[model samples]
Each structure stands twice: as C-alpha cells, then as structure tokens.
Target: MLERNALTFNPGRDQDAQPVGSFTDVRELQQELQGHGIQFLAEADEGTTGPASFIVVDPDGNPVIVDQHV
Candidate 1:
C-alpha cells in the first residue's frame, strides 16, 4: 500500500496478493513515470472526502500502489 506518511519502500505483500509500495504522493510518482513513457494500469479514484490512489505495474506485471491519505 502507498502510505502517505512513509519514507523508503519497505517491501511486503498485500491481501490482494500484491506487494505494497513504500512511497507517498501518488501524483508526483505518477508524473515521474509518465515522463518515462510509463502508463498507469488505473488512475486515482478520488472522493469528496476520503482516501485516493492509483495503480501501476512493475517489471513483472505486478500491481504497485501510489496512494495519498487525505
């Protein structure tokens, strides 16, 4: 999971059987990826008052998270 208050990536797995990301600021990371021609598997699903996140794929086609806790 993309923890908004996290630092370095502490590798781990999630309930969905996906590895959790260790970074915050989904949009910033997304921009960085876009600069390199990387596309998101899914975009952030924001709400009027709740959490938001986006999804992308790793080299092995595994889903990675970029999240913001607001």
Candidate 2:
C-alpha cells in the first residue's frame, strides 16, 4: 500500500491541461481556507501573483496541494 498520497488542484487548467476561461486564483483559495481555520504545511505568498502553490493536510493525513500555473 502507498504510505503517502497527495491531491493537487490546478486553478487555471482543466483535466486535459487546457486553459480555462475563468477560475478562482490560488491566493484567494488559500485565504478562504485560512479564514475557515485550515492550517497549511506550506503556503504561497499572498502578495505575489501568477504561479504559486500551498500544501495542507487532510483529516486522513493526506496532503492536498493547490497549485496554480497560469
């Protein structure tokens, strides 16, 4: 069995890796989650724009990554 697992979300791309017409920014997502009291293992700088990423652990101890590549 795999001991570690991670889920990644790409804000500006679809499952096929095509750019989307519109999507929420990664920073916004991070802020919203933080507001909800979710803690992050790693976080992107909210001051910056464009490509960024942040990591948070799920209830099951799996890492969830929100990565933006716009």
Best by TM-score: 2
| 1-70 per-residue lDDT for model 1 (tens digits) | 6534322222233545475565345555556778898877776543333355667777765667665564
lDDT of each: 0.56, 0.94
Per-residue CA lDDT of candidate 2, range 50-69, in tens?
A: 99999999998999999999
Q: What's the residue-level lDDT of 61 in candidate 1?
A: 58
Q: Give the TM-scores of the predictions, in the order they appear.
A: 0.50, 0.93
How does model 1 fare in lDDT? 0.56
Ten contiguous residues minimizing lDDT sum, candidate 1: 3-12
**Runs with alpha carbons beyond 4 Å of true place in candidate 1:** 1-24, 45-50
Q: After superposition, how far is residue 49 of candidate 1 from its true place, in Å?
A: 10
